[model samples]
Target chain A: MSSTPVFITGLGAVSAAGTGCAATLESFRNGNGNPCTAAREETPIAKPVFTVGDPAAIANAEEMRTLRLATLAVDEALSDARFRKRPSDIRVGVCLGTTVACQLNDIDFYRELRASGQASAVVFDRYLRGNLSAAVAERYGFCGPTLTITNACSSGTDAIGMALAWLRAGLCEAAIAGGADELSRIPMAGFNALGIMSATACAPFDRDRQGLNLGEGAGILLLETDAGVARRDAPAVLTCEGYGTFGDAHHLTAPREDGSGLEAAIRGALTTAGCAPDDIGFINAHGTATATNDAIEGTVLARVFGTDCVLSATKGYTGHTLGAAGGLEAVFTALGLREGWIPASAGYKNRDTSIPVAPVTRMTNVTGRYALSTSLAFGGNNSALVLGRQP
Target chain B: MKTVLGVHGIGMISVCGRGIESHADAYNHTQSADSSSPIRVCRVADEILKDRVTLKKMRRADRFSKMSALAARDAIDLAGLRVSDGGIRLGIVVATAFGPHRATFEFLDEILDFGDAGVSPTLFSHSVHNAAAAYIAIMLGSRGPACTVTDFQYPFHAGLMTAAVWLHEQRCSHVLVGYTEESSTPMDRILAQRHRGQPSHEPVLFNFSPYASKMFSEGSVFLVVTRPDQGGVALDLDRFKTGNDRISGLGSLWAAFKDGGLHLPQH
Candidate 1:
């Protein structure tokens, strides 16, 4: 049996709010939003993306343009973990989830290479494949196992889950786990082609909900084994009680009509955490605001936790970060638990009749020990995580 | 004390060949790339793998994942378990430095060209990292834990560690491990962009069998590892008692023992 309790020693996030965990947490508490009109595209929806920084802003930016959004998020998370520069003796493992990394860069680099026949294309090698984790490892001076998970939207949650396992198995004293994605024109075009991109703002679980806006960001959390935590001075924000992952294989993109796969994932998480429905105070829902995701997730929540659980989707704040959704949502859930305040679900007004669950439309307060964060992704990948106050 | 692990069955495929004989032949040939070329690649020609597997869906899977699944399947069959009846508590795990780069880039092309309209759902679905594991599970009808791991460098070894933990926890009876690295159009583009003046390298996949500790090779490595039984085949891991095998390069000890082969590659 696992005897020791793992703790959150540090956090790093690169979201619309800013680059630091403290900034993100502050935005969450103050309800600061990072929405802006899209700068490059003429399409109304494409405008107002949560861009990190202008490509022209950074030094030698084009050389590393292929770098994934997960890289940014991971850098912050490692910084958040508070590893001193060139520190030795810290066994750090990294696990990240994302649907794609530097996919946008790949597209540009390939296009340019094909067009010019000159190698003057975008820097695709910098963020190719596992280099995202390698970059983080090199940045933080960690020399342990590195794992990257890509399970649609649930990838981020799975990353965190694996981090917990890394700690539980005593593989590493500390781990930096999260998910990230830099917006790719390919996914945006695909979603748009699928006719899911909302023309305006995404209104998850709302009757007037149109569709979702593809956004880019990264969310990362630092996890430490019990021994590592005991050596640290800061208190843990929240304890990760359990995480469960499942795949439907039912359909590629669409979820099960009955939400059976999602149901199984939620039950698995709850069972693993030994928590009951009544114990949960808030739900950081996947809530893509698409007709399919919202309806299915809404039905599953209503059936499992009833309509009373405070539900919210942060996509309004950070357009669906895809692979990073779960990690970002997990971070949001942890922040909510630590701050003792439930955040308001942006772009939600009237709850859709199809979804009987009552989504928290405004900021509310609740004092509960447990909370649940759920994610449903393309290819029917589903996952749920349970977080609670430490005893 | 933690239980020691062993490897029982092993399979691998690459530009070299499939199975153990192919491994020995390829290495003896000194199949290194020519340093004088602008781009050097050790690629498994499309016709070769297609001829061997005789599976049509092989086209849909990225080369890396195809090699991965092939290596895993070879290992599973070598283990001699009846998957139809579900005898072994089998799980499928694979590590790849890049997850389906070619297909990903293809999806990008389709989405960009067609404006994301009428993009093949099949292409979009196959672009995911776990698609290989999902395909392997469906092909093998495996109900046990199925996961896809990526970490850019030596992802297969990292996956090996993960499988080890699963065994330690008694989560599964036997775990099948495979790793493959394939070239992508974008990967080439990225390489050219990164080291514009430096010599280029081609995509390569390295496979490993449990009996082999042959490092520095690129291909898929498949090994069936089992819990130690009194009569079961075992590879003694006395040198790696502490679990901190990072420096000792003891990641494949469990694979070696579980492979059940008499010979092990000596460094």
Candidate 2:
């Protein structure tokens, strides 16, 4: 945990589960999930995906869908933080993580350019203006350090960690940090090409798990220093206690077989928090249901937290949201810490004997102060966050 | 006590060439004005990327990853540091304005030519923004904290800030922080269209005007930063500056470092 107090005063999330935190909690409580097959127009492959309902309803005319998702979550976070408008007294920064938003992979625009040697500048201009953090900072008129972390799947977790670093460094008093990525055909195609897309819904850690299903959403946290929280009189129920990230340095797209990288990250987080493995109440795993990912992550989790450690993989509720996975899981972990309960890890059936641990099959109650959320990404990046509730 | 960071070593690759010495040579010698092409872009040469040893580890890596790995390796070598020697925790922070667009476009071409199902998984994997950072870590066998940050403005500055935080927080013993960008055809076309009427010239340094003639350039620059107590050349992070009218991404920083624009600390 950081010596300097960093509180998550507010939480905002929008996903296939629903548009707000309340709706998502309701879905979680009911143990229900919403996943549908991709429309033929979206992609030729028939893969299940969890997409936000009616993105157009929340988006402006000319903004990217990814930005629209981010805007919705930001609006909700601000409202949850009890700020009617931008706070004038504090230096607020914007740090966001994203994968699709950082790429210039507009298929139609590229097709046009490749065919006619010239394409419309509209898409290019939107990309130029759509730096995730820059757009959010410009929209709300924030004047502190702003950055967009593109560390693949761990981007969101790393973004939040970076914000904690910023606050500890006294560069910003408050920050809006998390991640947002839209469900686009580009990644769908890419993952399909990689043969990691399950035709049916994802079943993380299940014995017969196929692969991961893609999802789209945004998850944002209103993080503030102790002074900023006191200034706003915000309810500081949850705190970002510790963060640790380590690279495997092994493969471009696979976890290290030995799982030492992930082990170090988990240990690093625990060391930072000054807590023992037994103190952690539960873990929200980065269980993408792909065979290698589950095996490696499961082995590591079991090694660190013991085979009997209470854990759940929420990716079944929200398909693997890529960069947004860490943010959404972080918010879910904070909620778990605050609500004193965690939903069942959906879609899990029998446990894989090859892996030592199994996820919770039903709703469970917990009474610990801290919970861990872990994310593993392409490029062998593993990140873990320890969230705590005020005693 | 305030934490101070020093630049222990620097490695860079640009259109001018590779290494700090090449950059210094380019900084001292002025280039004759070339008005040959309206689309002014200073692209890294294929010759500069022909390192056999580095290429052996990164055979399938794209140009973006290639550029980033070479520079990062050079920085470690110049620092006379062996990551495997001591239990030195070496963290890496790679910053980029646009990341690996050429690979992205190539993946798109696969979709257009061979259909989505037929696309190459290797291409898809390499198209991601962090592939460069991952390649750097693998080439050096570094297992420390690695992050890749993106921004349209001040990416390198943001990277330096992240590195400073890591150093101060004692997350790592040394940090290889850098920025990498690659010139792509689609981006070149966009730039040509955006700057169609303006006169193109070699980018002028230290001209902070809004309307200065600037050319798009692509390369990678990595700096080995450690606690000031470790000692090399002091870098005052407080005085670091960034602007839209700068020469280019890492090119501008390399020029400033070589020109002595960044003052050494009094300590």
Candidate 3:
């Protein structure tokens, strides 16, 4: 990997907090989050979810909700980076992290197959293009290497990490890295069966927290190389310092009781970024509010950052967006660094005594150049990204 | 910071049979095309692993996890690296388009058969997309970084690039990067519907899969990658990126998208 810094020049976000980066920032600042009151169409469970706003007028539904959400996010990021007017060839790369959209579990089609063992190709084709990195790349006319990572919830963070590797490896001049997933019945059913979906809006890090509320959205960042930025005259927002990931290899759905994988991943990120634990201004934790996840992550955070560490868990604001969680949190972390305020951990009133970790209940100002974001996912995949303020 | 990795070992599994020989033979067939069936990747039957001693722990494991572990063992043996030593740093990266769908579907069945409250946790445990990658690391006793990527568009390329980055960053001295796909009834049915109303042609691997005949086969290809100075055929990702690339494991992936059929890059 090149020692040269990788810059996050532009960013876009669309989540339950609302569209655009400013909306989420304002919601975080005001503690106003909207979790859907009713279940989605044909959903198997009654659990609430956080869904993104309507599509931009220009983005048609034919593009699919999942793909359109991504396009909308990317467009905002590009415009934020001031690349809309200046159109120069800068070899772009697209790496998206997703779950339902990328997989083949169309319930209606599967229901028909289960009934009569038959279905139509049209539905399959639609499902095929619904969630893919190539589709997003093709949509934007990008020819750089495209990859879709499905490491479950940790995917978005890994995508950002992978995009940084691509930049350091000189794979492309600029890259689009983030994650997206639409709310679907299949996952809702799966999580319900597993007994993790909260019936109401989730209260992350709360002592009496029930479980995670499912949500849908997309978070994107436009990364540019020095040469690309110089050519396009784009402003660098923040530096993508380092990314580190490791798997527990201990269980499939459950994280290790010790959280050794996440600890190692954090250490790896710190080592890669050459930043000390004290240097991280605040942490954007993957506090899903599930019993095991919260305990494992909270324990790890307490041990690493000590009791004084200011932590934030945004799941309360936007629910657990699964694959998109990492990207959204990373964008929030970037916005926090740029604006000099860390969003409070939404829905958190009291901390769990057993886990022994607290979160920022109000948007708090901090003074530091580096921030850490962590994702503990289903595959026992633990990924951490170190985002640093640009000098 | 660019480093070369020697392709110390290679392991493959498909429906044709086990070992590299079976996979190689399956693709080299010169017979004519006249079949009315969707191409399925070769699967590992119980009889195949009945004799293998390394898979004793896989008795209760899902086939997806088993395939990745079995293929990785073969590659480790071929690479001449003793994983039991635990001294060699290893990173594992596995990529698949349809991840552990057999188990995922089974979990779905459990949910329907037994209501949400009565579902089995074990079933859901094996159904996650990263299960196989986790199993691979555990089976190898590799304490290094491990990751799983799912993307139908060139998973091997993504996996390879990841492996290369791990090598360059010195995160892991050796990376076990591979691809694993399992054939499932629902997926097969979906593919069948996608290609329905037309006669199925003979199976062709690495050939042009023009929307109509895209080869969605199952199987795994694992390579033990190390520094070039260690010897054997060197794997250079940048070389493949620029041109004149003959990357092992990632056969003509370019053919799938290009209307102009894929031509093997010059050696």
Candidate 4:
């Protein structure tokens, strides 16, 4: 646990559901946010994915779509935090979580190089500019420690958790912690090979759901130290109370069927927050809509928070955004804390009978001080965060 | 006062060999870069696993994970600590630049050749960044917190900082932090093309000053970091500098720590 409060001062996201706070909120208000788009020539999986981003801008930047989405998300977050206008002397750091975009292997470039003995350096040069967080820090003129975490799906949530540690260790006074990933053929085919990519819009927690629909986006949150928040007079979006991350040495792709890893993570978060399980108002589950993932996650929730917990899994609305899911859902969790309500789990029509609890099927109002957001990624990594409303 | 932490033991598997004697000899002899593709990790891990009865399960594991598991096992043995506890107290941090590139390429090749339907699940599963860390945990029976971070510029620094924080918070009794780099055709070519100007005959310090130091190597480095007061070489962390060719002087750091911090390298 942190000695002082760490607040989420600003939030930004660009996802398949929508872009920017207003656009995303409006999409949710209107209901049914997962809008499908045609697959691109590069990512020719044939399955309609919830691909979202500015294609022209992404092509123009050529710095990589992940970097561009990060820039957009960071710009919006800075503007929201009012850091764009007010310059402070506090040390700032950047921690990002990413997957497909962060890797250096460019299949097309490598193929061309292999075939013709020559390939353009556009992709290679971008890869050399450093990792995702370093690019972000250079763009924003940040001087503190910058790290890029590549822990698959839990990267974003774990990134935020690590940033909190930085604050506690006096390594940085403020931080931009989040995740971003661009849709690419590599992961699409990989997940499809894994048999987890759904042909239709994902139906998280629904008994008859096929699998996840791949999505792309960025989610960023600006965090501040207590003194820095007071000195800068920054408004708190919500308070990050606790964070816990653990791994299961089980299987490479499959989570522990007993849900031990996830259960430990949730218990760690709750313990650090100094809160009981009943104190949590709602939960935003990883909820990838895969039979294995949803079933394991539900059992873990029941084991930790009892059967009557009010929870929702938002992947149905945004699709499974891969690495960005954690950050995107963190923003959603923060919004739930701020607005005191959580939207229904979109497309969840039926529930599995084996699970003790079902997802929140309707937009539900809640009155509580805290909410929990959980993420379970590939490689058996499980992470949970406890967030509290501003007092 | 805060409990200080230092690197207690070091384990590595480079093109040179397994332990410190081989690495030091290679460093002194200007060991020629392996011209072979995908620079392979030595059989130190296989030898270590020879005595253990659980080798059957790891037969299908990728080389990247094998290198990490071997390096971590050696480091823990050197440190003489028990990390294979049933409790959720240990922390494992693995840092890498490429992160299982061989497996990744193989997986991608399957996708390109056979489409998604024909790709193997095993290949796809091992392609993830954290698979190596997971393997390390499994081998050690460590049910602790684990994470994998990737970066080309400063991977070891990031891992060290995270380990320092974990020790500071007393979240774990000790942390096994490791850094691994694998040689791939593209990476080797990029390094060769970029660093052609540097003197390649001698093992000069990889300096990042001015602009491009232009060198990349394949190997793994593991450090058993514990509380500073518990006794080890006090690592001299320089003020964060921009990228350079100066290689990480882990060898010097290990020597200084093991010999009481007298021979800190100038580089």
Candidate 5:
């Protein structure tokens, strides 16, 4: 067989639980609430915001605004995988996904430049477009491939898939793959304009689910080829078996009601993994609290995994991290495999009568070999990734 | 060892000249134009562009997608593949550091100022990061797997790798790979604000081929790849492999392409 098995050696997350990966994982295990009430908003916000602590505390270093979340995730992942010395000998690559690329910074600088026509070198420095990925590569001194995948919500997932392909193809010895999107007014206003923002706490797979609370965070996984792993001391956390991607092509902002595209993506991923429907032990669904996405995802899951498979949508806790959703969710699935415990859906309450699928309502002691992580984007693109447990 | 996948046709548009001949000539006579400072020359002149109809409708279409479509069309023509008559099973893969940046900034400005008010649906629709690939698919009527990859470094190589994998899997007979970047007003304004000393320059395109002589410029480039038995476009593509002698596999790619073509200059 020409297939090469790739392993996930490192894991990191910079989410509501602060910066470190272990802290975030511990917080999740303890079922701690990361959501906090916003002080600026006039109205009493129903849904809590998971801002990465005070922006001012970390905002002094403008570069931190561009890469703080990424730095946290990458650091934690590198530590978790126990790859001590930075491996520059082999081609080390990075793939990040995000829609909010320092747009806030650009907006702040543009206001000055547009009005005065006098440009501040500091103003436009962070928005240099390639600065984020280049910064990561530069900081870690990994001289290989570096890319940013920005397909809205699927950006992180697609970046991971791309990294997986690169590793299998022997293009790079290892890759740091994930996505980061700090909360910005641009996305906040865009979602609000679309009328998808829920004034109350967002609930996934719930009958009364209104919408999603826009959250900001980052997650990264360190993947390596077989040759690179020979030098590693720590065992692999999980193996990325297969990935499948397909566009909606039906609509620009909405998913197909028939769930054709999502079904195709799910089936394609399963086929690539050489797995049957029953082989999927856990499903990290793209259960954005949006009505259409949850309903469509429910229908697709019923068709693919049936009603019996254990499932939970993590957005209720993480909020919709936009581009980082896939990466963060993938870490959750991988961690689930390592810990032998399935995390609950966090906020799912009443089941939607219209959909046949049921999300696992509480934490369960489930030991399974394979987990499927999925994501759906604004452009009707659907991506499914199958992560196989370490052998 | 994997079989060598030869390249038959390639096209690109950037700050560089367009067409295989112009690209070859521009690079054959290598003289750096002093554009006011240490700034590099990058852009495709308007005079050399063919198939103007394809770009007429996309008003807000950034230079990135326009360059990609134009170069891809050129490659398709160079390969003698006519979609008007009967198009083959074609796939397109494009790589970029960013996508439709001009449109994205415009949308941001409008939405921010307008305060979630009624915005241009057209602008909002085309502002997607994948608009470049989607537009190419629509233009070519290619229903195959069309993907746009965005990564800051080696995007072109990444795009080609994707195309190669698709071809290796026999998913499609031929795949067209493109790389595009456009100078945006936001970028310019920001650059000027950040660096008062630097001068801004226009962007251009440059095409590559297994047959074309070397010249260095970045814009858009498309390669039409075919399986060995097809005996299609008579160009060599095996020379572009980045593998070393240590690997026993892919020997054909190494032998057939051993220094037969001009290598792409590092960015």
Candidate 6:
């Protein structure tokens, strides 16, 4: 890859926290999370879920909910980047990560087919057209490469990382990258079956954390190469310095107990950025509040960055948005660096004694040039991104 | 400048058979369309998927994972590389249009039969799209970067692009990049409904029209790609970016490789 810096020209986010970057920052400033019971009629489980406040208002009836969420974030990102639409002259790739959107797990369609050997083609058609990155590229007239990453939970981070590679390789002058997923009964039932769904709100990294609460939303970034940013005269406050990903090669559902894969990914990101561990201001951890995830991730964080690395888990505010977690946390990390403060790790009242690291308990000011965001996903995929702020 | 990657080894499994030799043989002697069946569906035989030795550990794995693992393992073996060998940072990238739909439906069946809380966790875990990549990683003991991408259009091309980027960035010593798809009952039903009255015949290669009749197939293809200096069939990554409709899916890419139609640049 080229040595040129990939600049984050715009940011867009939507979750239980709020819609758009401004609203999300406001929610972080207040340190209050909105966790409610699954309100969709199709969901049988009564576990708490973090859903976007209004989806119908943003999307038409013909579009799938996941595509709707993605479109909303992409539009906000484009607007923030001062473009009404993708530039006509430049090549811009669209790489979005998604889980729920990639599968054809429509229960009603399956039920109908199983019963009568026939079903409506609407669901099938929607699925065929709902490849997240392709849909975004079509919507925005992006003419560069397009890919929809489906590496389980770390998909968004991988998508962003892939886009970074594309930019550095000169495949595209700019790219729209991140992740999006909508609340669905399929995952709700699946997660509940796995016994990882928390009955109440999630408390990531807390001592008495039970498990994770599902959430729905999208997080998107408009990343541009140095030349692209300069050509458009766009404000460049933060640069995506580096990205690294590695697999545990151990289990499908569980992370490696040793955290070797995650450590390698983090160290790889640091090495790519040419920075030491001490230069990082804070880390946005993928703390899903599940017993195994927290224990393993906490151990790795303490081992790599030491116990006082100024890290926090934001899943407390957004729930475990699955594919969107990485993207949302990346945006949150960049926001923290640019805005000069980090929010308290919400829902974290007591730290577990077994884990050496305690997350920031209060809204804290930070002065640093760079921050890190990490995601450990199912299928034992671990990914990390290093974002640097311009002094 | 375009990045040229060396195709160190290739592995594939399809209706034609298993391994690159089988593919080359099938390409040399093309079989006439089977007119007996109303729908011309190219299905991988059950025998083609049976590998008791390599798949002993993956007994519980779905067909998607099994197919992916078999092809990936074959590629690694053909490349004369062992996962046990130290200092080999092997990365994996698997692309698919529809990933593990059969497993997903099975998980849904569990959900419908038993309530949400009573469903089986194993089925739920396997239903994920990345399960195949995970299975490959575990089978090979590769601890490098692994990624899975899904796209109806240009999935194989996208996987190759990502693989090239990983190689250029020196993320891994060698990358196992491939595509896998499984034909499920619902997919067949959809295809049947879409082409209810159309005549059934073998797919016409290089037909890029919008309204062409479609015949669906299922299988996996993998290639071990390394830097150009490795001295193998050189693949120009720029050719993929031009949106060559003739070389769109895995089937076409496999055919191109088997027929030596790729026009690989000489190093």
Query: Of the candidates shown, which would achieve the greatest TM-score relative to the real structure?
Result: 2
For candidate 2, give the lDDT of residue B176. 97
Candidates, ranked, lDDT: 2, 6, 4, 3, 5, 1
In model 5, state the lDDT of residue A227: 79
**DockQ for all candidate structures vs. native:** 0.28, 0.66, 0.43, 0.54, 0.21, 0.70
Q: Please give, for residues A33-91, the per-residue lDDT of candidate 5 as tens digits.
A: 45666522232223465677645534644664537777778888888877754674778
Per-prediction interface RMSD?
A: 3.4, 1.7, 2.4, 2.1, 4.0, 1.2
Q: Rank the candidates by DockQ, best first.
A: 6, 2, 4, 3, 1, 5
Q: Candidate 4 lDDT, tens digit per residue, A1-391?
A: 4567888888888887777866776666655756465665455567758767456645644578778877778888887888853355888989889987657557787677656645456777777674789889888888888888888999999998888878877888889998998877778777887788878778888888889888888889898888778887888758888888777888778898988999988988888778999999899999988999989999889888899998878887777777788888998898888887788888788878977778888777877899999999887899999988876
lDDT of 2 by residue, B105-157 (tens): 99999999988778899999999999999999998999999999887666777
> Chain B TM-score in candidate 4, rounded to 2 decimals?
0.80
- TM-score, per-candidate, Cα-based: 0.81, 0.94, 0.89, 0.93, 0.81, 0.94
| lDDT, candidate 3, B98-203, per-residue tens | 6788887776666557654566666666777777787777676665677777655556667877787777766777888887777666666666666656554344
Q: Tens-digit lDDT track for model 6 on B1-267?
A: 357877767888765678756654544544443343335656667787789888878989999999898989898887888876886889899988778988998887777788666777888889999999999999988899999998776677788888888887788889999888776666666667766777644543222111345555567878898888876566777655422123333344445555655553221
TM-score of chain B of each: 0.74, 0.85, 0.79, 0.80, 0.69, 0.83
lDDT of 5 at A199: 71
Model 2 quality (TM-score): 0.94
lDDT of 6 at A311: 85
Q: Highest lDDT: give the candidate number.
A: 2
List the candidate numbers ranked by TM-score, top first: 2, 6, 4, 3, 1, 5
Tens digits of lDDT, candidate 3, A267-307: 88998898999999989999898888988888898888887
Model 2 chain B scores worst on lDDT over the 10 consecutive residues at: B203-212
lDDT tens digits by residue: candidate 2, A5-52: 899988999888889899989989988666887742467878999988
- Off by more than 4 A, model 2: A39-41, B1-4, B27-38, B203-213, B243-267
- Superior candidate under lDDT, 5 versus 6: 6
Better of 1 and 4 by DockQ: 4
Choose the strongest candidate by DockQ. Answer: 6
